[model samples]
Target: MRIVGISVLCLFCAFSAIVFFTYYRRNSATFSYDIVLPTIFGNSTEFNTSEIKKKRRAFVVNVFASWCTVCMQEHQTWKEISKRTPIDLYGIDYIDIEDNTLAWLQEPDNPYIAIAADYSGKAAKAFGLREYLKLLFSTKKVNWCSI
Candidate 1:
């Protein structure tokens, strides 16, 4: 009975440690903007990384996929946001076809100022794309005009 209790206690401690470590590691990882994301459409255009970062206009780096229904749904909100504020909205199309991204943008309802195709997924990873989903989940209103 003593041996069983000790083993159970050890197991519990080990499990708790693992959970704590994972939670700490994920939360502790700071988000940075050192990444120079490549552009799919702006390749022929004159836009550069510094130009994007240094622009006085507020920028929203939206990482999305053409297949993602959420991205399509957010288009209207983005449009409204753009109109109400002096924002330079950029998009990183996470794993999408260039033609499709271009076609979708050409649709009368597009809102992005610049759209980049993240073919390798590196740019999305750099931008902490997953964390942005949490923003959408929250109830707080994100007002760019006030920012």
Candidate 2:
């Protein structure tokens, strides 16, 4: 009985530690603008956040995919919003075929001032993007703007 109790306690502690660390790592993960991916359209082959900041006081980095149904649904909204906001909006196409991304963007007004294709998946990893539609708003402070 004593052995069983000790084993159970050890298991509980181990499980607790894993849960804590997972939570901590996910929450503490930071997004960086150092990502460089192939440009699908607009601007250039490189994504320079600083250059965008120079054009606008702030900017929005949206992570999207060509196959995402929700992303397609929101594309029009983005086009409308971009037409109104002074802030420059950029796009990172999450793992998808480059041609598909371009086609999808061409269907709409293409809200993004610049869009990049994340062929290597490094851009998504660098952005700490967990979802297909996560938006990072850079103003006085960087904030995760999920819509």
Candidate 3:
């Protein structure tokens, strides 16, 4: 009876762990540290990571690769979202060739208010991304028209 009770408790713990981990992994949408990424276009400069956060009530940072088919399909959804919402969207081009990303963005309505490059994936690591991430909720405001 003692051995059976212990086994049941262990099984319950395992199940609970699985559920917790799955939820935590899926819902982690913010980061505590700053992520300064370089621009793939124009002057090759890094943008003010924290200052952008001060202006807007909230923003979304999307991780995408120029080569990912899912990202291409989801791009349309982002375009639609941009049309309906006032929230700004930023793009993190993940480990992709800069030229290819530039062309890719040109084909779309360009929903991102601005885009930053994560060539070495440091920004993605800072954001605690364990896998391909669609959206990461953040706060920021900027005159992206000038970027």
lDDT ranking, best first: 2, 3, 1
**Full ranking by TM-score:** 2, 3, 1
Q: List the residue pairs that clash in candidate 2.
A: none
Clashing pairs in 3: 53-140
TM-score of each: 0.63, 0.73, 0.70
Instruction: Give the CA lDDT, 0 to 100, for residue 24 in model 3.
Output: 81
lDDT of 3: 0.75
Least well predicted 10-residue stretch by lDDT in candidate 3:
138-147
Scored against the true structure, residue 96 in model 2 reaches a CA lDDT of 90
> How many backbone clashes does every candidate have?
0, 0, 1
Pick the lDDT winner.
Answer: 2
Identify the superior model by lDDT, candidate 2 or candidate 3. 2
In terms of TM-score, the best-performing candidate is 2
**Per-residue lDDT for 1-147 in model 3, tens only?**
999999999999999999998888765555444677787743437644575677666777788899888998899999999899987777889889999999988874788877888889877777766677556675444322211
lDDT of 1 by residue, 62-142 (tens): 777767788778878888987887766677778888888777777674667667666887655655556333111111143
